[model samples]
Target chain A: MKIKLCLQKSTPRKYLFHFIADDRAWIDLLLSKVALIFVSIIILAALYHLAADAGRMNHDRQLDLIAQDFCSAINSAGKSSYETAGGNIYFFDAYNKYGNFGSGINASVSGEYVSVSFEENGRRYGSVKPLMYKTLPLSEDEVRGELMGAFSANGNISQPIPAFYGYTAVTEFLAALGTKEENLNTSMEVHIEKTLIYIHNLNGTEVKELEYILVHQ
Target chain B: MSTSLFISDEKAFMEPHNDIISTAMIVIGFVIFAAILSKTYLTYDDNSLSLENYRQAALIANDVVGYPAIQGSRQDLISAYALDSITMPAADREMHSDFFQRFSSNADFFVDVRTDDGSHAWIIDRYEASSHDGDIIAASVPVVIELGNNARCVPGTVTVRLRKNKWI
Candidate 1:
């Protein structure tokens, strides 16, 4: 009995096949893929760290510039003539390059340094600049009373006093003496005294003399 | 024939190691690029700081030439009498200190006043060479020097040299 012979054509496989010579080759492929992913993760992490460091450096530079600018303004005012009226005003705005306001921007004077600090990404950054001369911080009341006394002695109470002591009303004085809050913006008034002003310390024990006064305006 | 040709094509198969090697090379290149970029940025920052120091020196020079205490009979003039008092071998320490107080305390600098004819020269607040280890930025301004005794005015230059310190 002769069986009927039949010829059939096989269709080509649509998907490509990768032949693994051995289990070791399979393990090698798997390990290499894992290593590539690990390396990519490491590269990404490194890039992230580098970017963060650069951002921190930029923020530090901004703080430094703010301190330097405030210090320079103080020095400039100190060098001006004592007879110059209406001391110069320095406006400090803690605005970043992106035009967004910085958080917790504050400036203060302690010892011989003017320090400006701000917060970024939950981190606090600060910079300090040395003052050209001895400086004292005075309140509105103290400044006004001192000016009134000085002007009265000079027999020029009606005339405006030189170096930011000329305002007659408290409102005008406060306007010139800007807020001292730790906000996005502030102003400082720098003035030189015609004569040395003696002040008693907080304890009213030690006397300190100041020729330059930095007021929050 | 087509299947044979496709299988024989060189691009049909790639070694897995090549992927990792290429990725590593790319990462290395990126790192190098980043290093160079940071280096350039730091250089730019340093250059800008130096420029600022030079500007500060220039301002100090201008201010020194116009100082009320050292000014001659006219504006923008330096008095020989005042210069002598300030720069004499036994200069008054108090007066020198007072004069320097007019400038920023943070600035480490000195001034040199001299006549164009080399008749007179004075160094104000001369700092020792070893005191600072940095570049010196100098700015000069022309002024009229009045000889108090002879009642004569001569051309002079005031040079202000600022030591570039990290703090400033």
Candidate 2:
């Protein structure tokens, strides 16, 4: 009877050990597969981030080029205007105005694309002033469109999407030459001080005009 | 019966078991994955920092060339200071303190300005030996020409730099 009891105990114990070993092997395989899937997700995420970052950089570079072109044109025009008698300024709402002085202007330009209504002070004139400005562009619309498309495909969440991103720009222009604070509303971005201007763009980005006051009187 | 038990034991030992090798492969795969992840992060960080430096350089160059006291036409001034080109101006040494501050806030800059007759040349070089702080790399001087006493001519090159802490 004792021997029979011993055999029974031994048989069950051996089976239990084998069973545990088999289960452990299967668990290890599952764990490895899960780890592989997680790692792949991480790699994909990193790739997406890198691609997006590159795109952003490319966009910034293009914006810089546009800013440089605008600055150059405006500065050239301002120099000529300041040197002219009466400090005459030819105001153009971007497309509405084209410039030619000692430097030849290549094209005839005019349009309503540039927005402005000017108020000139009755008194002294500064050597510097607002030359031109155009509205800033925002990437919010494209981003939203893509996001909306994704949401529609997923058909998961029901939430209102924000229409636009917002941004603000603060620019300081020192009075140039003999330029002074005047009641010139040449740019909507300019503040009451007339030296510094703050521009708020509801669309995440917008190019605003920078006002320059002349240095030497 | 004992022989048969011995044979069974030998058979178990001889079975083609690759569990050890399989475990090693899995570990190696994880290690390789981690290494790539680390590399990706480092590359991204370095790229970002370098790009930031370039952008900062652009901003400083714009402001420096626009300063009134710096004098000279916009194109000429930019070419002189940022491009290391010659200038045609009578530059005073005292006038460039503001320019130096504009270059960088951490270090002193030096320039070699050479003037022959009415023509001027500026070669700007910065001490880029230190990694802990900002150092001068090289700069272009905007040259201003002037006739000194006895009808002789002299040109001065201005050095500009910024202060920086050791990054390490």
Candidate 3:
């Protein structure tokens, strides 16, 4: 009876051990798959953050261009007339002549300073100037169209898109921020003191004109 | 009996298609890896900070050139800025002070004024070179020249140089 019991114990247990050994490859495979999934998620999350940073940079770049253009127009006006209050300043120096700077801006000159502002959500965004604010009645596109027609009428279609998107401004800020695009309204303004420039104007002294540019998008 | 057990074990090992799932996972992981690599590698910088500085310099140049020189509280028309101010800076201490105040900042700023013929040149600004390498943004804008008087307008160049910051 002792010999029979020993043989039974050794031989029967072999089947159970062999079953577990056979599944080792499958267990490794399952664990490897799960690890791969976890690693992929981590890498993807990191990439998402990088892409979002790039998007914010792009938005900032756009705003920078608009601000530069507005200041440039004002500088140009300062060269000739300090009496420039009402004019097509959005296309001043052809900064936004392409109508790319979306609408919601207003510009005008009051007293001795140039005034520019942008409106979003029924709220005006700008500095506290001495004069009251009034939203411009025209959009950037409309202003551009009118200017284009005027230029074309004079047989001078020299207006060209000023290499604004040389490399296609890559911006995914709204996407990365998981924010709605319609809610963001960007506006920028610049104020430059007009200098008194006396040129060949007989005996009349002339001061540089103030220019104001506003963009709403 | 041992031979029979070994045969059954080999059959069990081959029963599941484990290799298929492993290959699929590796392929998917590799694709994702490539995508992340491309996004990181194919980056193009669009930082126009230098250009913006140039534009800013140009704007300031306009103000400097357009500034009219006068006596008796700006009521009198007199040419204050001319080729002489470059040589005799003491001629307009107040004017120079005002300009220095306008363009003062943490950055190194310089205003090199000269004629188109390169005849007269002078610098009026606040600039100090840091102890390390840095980015320098400069712009040369034409000023409205005043022909007869120092406060008049004409065409001249106002070169502006601004060293932004030290690069690490």
Give DockQ for candidates 1 onward, in order: 0.20, 0.03, 0.10
In candidate 1, which residue pairs clash?
A132-B105, A177-A217, A178-A217
Residue-wise C-alpha lDDT for candidate 2, range B1-168, written one tens digit per residue: 988886776424323234545645766776686678668867975664444333333333334444454344433332333223222132433233223422222223334444534364554333324232344333434444333323332444333332222341
TM-scores of chain B, in order = 0.75, 0.50, 0.49
Candidate 2's TM-score on the B chain: 0.50
How much is the lDDT of residue B144 in candidate 3? 39
lDDT of candidate 3 at residue A112, scale 0 to 100: 20
**Order of quality (lDDT):** 1, 3, 2
lDDT by residue (B47-103, candidate 1, tens digit) is: 877776776787778767767778877776788888887773526654565576434
Best-to-worst DockQ order: 1, 3, 2
Clashes of each: 3, 34, 16
Quote model 3's TM-score for chain B: 0.49
What's the TM-score of each model vs. the native?
0.67, 0.32, 0.41
Cα displacement (angstroms), candidate 2, residue A178, comes to: 14
Error of 3 at A112 (Å): 16
Please, what are the lDDT tens digits per residue for candidate 2 over residues A61-89?
43333333333343333233122413223
Q: What range of 10 consecutive residues in model 1 chain A has the weakest lDDT sum?
A: A1-10
